[model samples]
Target: MNTMFDSSNPASAPRVWEVGALCHAIGDALQARFNPVAVRGEISGFSRAASGHCYFNLKDAGGQIRCAMFRRNAEQMGFYPRDGELVEVRGRLGVYEQRGDLQLVVEQLQRAGQGAWFEQFLRLKAKLEAEGLFDTARKRPLSTMPRGIGVVTSLGAAALHDVVTALRRRVPHIPVVIVPALVQGAQAPQSLVDALQKMYLLAQSGQGQEADLAQKSPLIDCILLVRGGGSMEDLWAFNDEQLARTVVQSPVPLISGVGHETDFTIADFCADLRAPTPTAAAELVAQPRELWLGALDLLQDRLESAVQRVLDRSAQRLDLAAQRLGRPSEQLSRNHLQLARQAQRLRHAMLFKLQRMTQNQQALQAQLPQSLQRRLEQQKQGLERMDLRLQLLDPRLVLQRGYALLTDTKGKPVTQIKQAPPGAALKAQLADGAVDVVVTQPRLL
Candidate 1:
């Protein structure tokens, strides 16, 4: 590199400088002449490098200027820098030596219409980010079922009403402790810090108004630092760097709901949780009551149905079990059939014996008269024979024929009539008739 300059001789040629030297001199002059500045322009060709550097062009109706935001300064940005968004950038004027291009090394950024105040907010955000206070690792997760919640905001702010209303609608039983504070104005920062401290003490002791409000409300599980929507200046109190640090170090997790969804603040970056609004934060902490009750009813119905099914199955089993036994009527019918068979056999045996006895009696009766007549006839014949023999011996034949029987006067037949009285009348005997002698006639001997 060489420089051409007029020598001390009069009428020397014009000065010339080497290309690098000239660029360096120009860059030095530009840096010294212009200092920290704010430029309003629309972003164009905005892109972030892999190394976390933002490269873009800030263009206006007239012209455009190149800009670069390094990783450190870019981390402080609350929203992505998109192309065509009007923005305000504050930084020093500089030149890229390698390219010899004029560019802005932006250290602060904000939406358009924000002037000095925006720059201050960015600087503070950058400072806190640099200190790692806004690190995601430092943020604690919100409790799933926090026993109690602490609120830090103005008592008169709409944000408080929104939060409390949402909480009551969702989980009315959960304890909420409010530590009132000024949400805006100069005193808001210290007031917020004091409210946070009071909630912390309430969590630790629960011996005062907080205890009375919620007798069972225990240690503060989380805190909500909220405020209604407002202008950047109105919400400036939340951007206090000290407040951000306090939120980061809170004993309980903190949720920041400082403004509308598009708005962001130091509190939002440093808090454990960030909600677009106070109501959203409340919804996040607890679920709606109706949802739980509906689930319980469904479970109860299922349980009852299951029990009924079991009972029906058991009753069916019992019916099947009872059917296994034979029917009583059938059993009795079988018993009766057996008894009838036994009775028939008994009746037949009795009839057979009675018939046999009746036959024997009839046979005896039929033979009795014949037997008696035979015996009586035999005796009568024997007597007739004897009578005939006697008649024959005594010439009874002549007597029976002539029918005469003579006897001595003594009625002695015969051989000896001596002893008979002569005066006695004689007796005659015949086979059919006999005449008796009147006298006591002695029979002839």
Candidate 2:
């Protein structure tokens, strides 16, 4: 102003470091104008960088903020933000010194309202619902009396206990199988889908020692997808379009009771049956004990009636037989005297039969001894004849009649002269006794 205050001072002129620091401070001050701000706006201009960073804009009626989300933070969010989707952002405002661009380092991004999420839900629901997923014709009717009931719920959730208790009260003997799963939050949707698939496969495969499509270790019959009442946000998992489709396509009839009496989800529309609450669902699947008891009473009455009918028929038959037995008359005893004469005639007829039998027996007895003596005499004569023939054919008798039989030392008959080998021992049957000799030379004759 006055020629550098009459004396130019290097310190007062500002050092290079101080000038650089001043510029940086001014940039920071500009950025501070928007720092630590909560911006509610629909996401736009979203781009993921090659460096694993996300670039997006948060814009509302008033203004917009450029947001950058690192890969680490972006991966943690359940839903990916798209353009025109309402989202809330929390970040620190900053300036890129080189580009001179204002930027926000996003620490959080969430749905601003039911606007975008509801719209997406509707779109998906319509798409799947149109595919017959929500068709009433595709739904399976619940068995009046299910042999077993399967429940899908979070293990520690109170809804599980409510369902179990309700089912037990309605039908105590029906077995209840619990397939534990997460029913809320990011994991809830997939967990529910998996559980539904498992039950469906089990029903399709039938009772056997084989695995199903889900490859679950244990099997089940029918499935009950249930959860306690909660806010729309809390029940959002069941509202998932994929989960709803799974429930609708399930082979096993699925009962959906995802919330309280007032609560409903997309799954409710697609399920085979929708119950207002978990307990109600359980009751729907189980048979009422009172009805079964009444049926038993009816059966007992029928059995009693049948038994009585049988007994009455048997009594009637006995009375008829007794009446027949009491009427044992033979033409009024053949007019008394005539009946007595007939009785005598029957006795005489039987006695004649006995007398004939006795005469036959006596004839048989007389013939027995005569036939025996004749047989004995004939047997003696036949023996004498046989003895005479034996004497004629006997070798001893032949020897006594002066005929001799020559045999080899081995008792072989010397029928052929060649059989008597030279120098072999021999024996001859003379009229008196055997004469032992030696085979010298065979006389061929």
Candidate 3:
């Protein structure tokens, strides 16, 4: 046999370099066999290639893994992870043919762990805000003095006792009804919400049944969710998204007093008002006895002052009227006497005016008869002159004076002989009669 190859074949066994090449090919085949995967880690060394591919290492405390995010994949991702940013990557594990190194081909990316939860919170907040759940118009105003108050909390919790004690201190006469339920743990969220609904139903139905006994309660006016301080996980029930939605959907006004002064939860945002502590919530809902007394005292002082002012004004008016009435009657009597004298003078002037009018009437009456007599005398003289003129103008009067008047045909007076024609009829008038005669011939003498 030959040293390089067996005598049966001219070919020799592959060299170390060739074997290395085969192993690289096997590794690439193996990488290609696996499908796309998702892995959550922090970005350790991130860099962008000129070809628009992102090269980065996904790392944790214990180990690190290299990854390559193509431009298409980067575009699909909502946010690109920066260095130290914890993220989840979905991709396939494959060997780089050029470098013979194993790497991830990223397809999708998203924030992981706490970042995921925060993002979810923001999404829920935005959804509720769009629905008008966090609107000021939806928030109910608290009653100034509610007849009954409802509390939802754990039975043995100190927060409950604190609220009860505070409420008693502020308003002893007001009634408080507790709906015991867990404020933490997996079942806490549902239990709190159920308790709230039960209280609301009881208030609406006018019936409150106890687990151990039966008793009816007055209408509940407000609900307070109180709990002690704890870590985010421990208080996770209060931060529940469903519970937050439930609080906003509740028709009654809700007061959230979860955790301590420094603690806050999602429930706090949905509630109508947030209190620093359970004690503070109770104090806000109830009026302090001392404060009520102070207000009453101020009102009393104002009433007294108002009454005094009114009395003072009335007394001043009465004094002024009395001073005016206290004057003597003699001055009034003298004024009346002056008025009477003025009236008498006016009456005398009127009587004088009447006397002058009577004298003028008598003068007119005396001149009436003389004026009538003068008119009658003038009328008689005028009548005599008209009579004389009538006698001179009358033809019968000339005849009566013994002078005959003659008229020819066509009734023309025969004062001139030339008026008659041959054989014309002529009329002669005496004093009382007229004679008709015929003119045989005309005498023009």
Candidate 4:
């Protein structure tokens, strides 16, 4: 029998492999065992490269694994993976031939049960959103020109320096109030609330002073709650429900500038405005002084132009009035000449009217005598004809012709026998006298 490790037996010697070949063999063994491996652990030092590839370490108390997610797989992730986030990954496990180390080529990655802290954050967010605390309608507009700005942050935070620097650079005239508070750990929430309350007091009544004395310190128009970028645990204070409620209670508009641009917290949703960074919050509250100055300059130019236009119009009116008036003495002389000409015309018109009237009166006098003679003759002839008509219509003339008039007792003329009945008393009226009589019987004809 031949022993495999026997030094004397060449046919039975163990095979030695190159480093690259050994790595390939181990990788092949790992693929055969678990090609589609799924792992669950907390992410550490997660980073996404400019090439869209991601590199991170998944670790547990007992072990850890190096993971790499290429651009394609990383793009499919629903949420950006941060350090200390618990996640599950599925990928091919293989050994890198370069450094001869084991690595995972991740095909899929997702949050591990949403993590405990993240789940709490979501629950609180949902609760607040239901209460309308996160409504866009509730969000207040930031003051375009805040009288003063208040900042609530840690004394040692770099966010404070960044905000102050930006504010100073943009609007040096605007005052800034710094209210130091704990921006991390469990105590940060209460500290931030207290700081904001103090700012409110200062804003309403300068440093607890009376309303009249509030001018001692510029009134705070808006407040900024800021902190530098950090992990979820490190920035957990901003997610506090109490802090979220307090953020909504700010007397002035509150601007939340916590963590990086990608980070979100409960306070951010409740704030009047959300800025990606502390410096951005400062920029939002205070517009550039140069911009305002430029606007004022434009207004001044417009005012000057308007004034010049008015002056030009007035000057033109004055010139027109001067041309119309000429000199006062010359104007008076012209008015006198016009008046004299009107007087001369009036005299000539009166003379002509008087002459015409006289001629008309002379002509009327000439015709008056003839008209009076003809009228008098015509009136005489009319009187003569009227006298003849009167003689013809006289009742005495009818009586003289032997005709008598009959009258009833009531003095009405009896033209019918019915008027003078048998028992009626009547009178016969002559031209010179009347005689009463009684009718025994009336006869017709």
Better of 1 and 2 by TM-score: 1
The TM-score that candidate 4 achieves is 0.54
* Ten-residue region with minimum lDDT total, candidate 4: 321-330
Best by TM-score: 4
For residues 25-68, could you state the per-residue lDDT of candidate 1 as single tens digits?
88889878897767889999999999999999999999999999
Q: Which candidate model has the greater TM-score, 3 or 4?
A: 4
Query: Tens-digit lDDT track for model 2 on 1-75?
Result: 455532356655644565456657766886667678767788889888888789988888888877789888876
Q: CA lDDT of 8 in candidate 3?
A: 67
Winning model by lDDT: 4
Global local distance difference test of model 2: 0.69
TM-score of each: 0.47, 0.45, 0.44, 0.54
Q: Residue 406 CA error for candidate 2 (Å)?
A: 88
lDDT of 2 at 53: 85
Model 4: pairs clashing at backbone N, Cα or C within 3 Å: none
Report every candidate's CA lDDT. 0.73, 0.69, 0.71, 0.77
Clashes of 2: 0
TM-score head-to-head 1 vs 3, winner: 1
Over 1-445, each residue of candidate 4 has an lDDT whose tens digit, in order, gives: 8535678888777788998999999999999999889999999989999999999999999999899999998875535788997888889999989999789999987777645676688789889999999989977788888888888999899999999999989999898877889999889889988988888888787545433445466688899999999877778899999889888888889999998887778899899999998888888988998887776556545534543454344345434433443222324446545644543454455446535644655523333345444553554454345335433444556666777778765656677778877778888867677788888977767
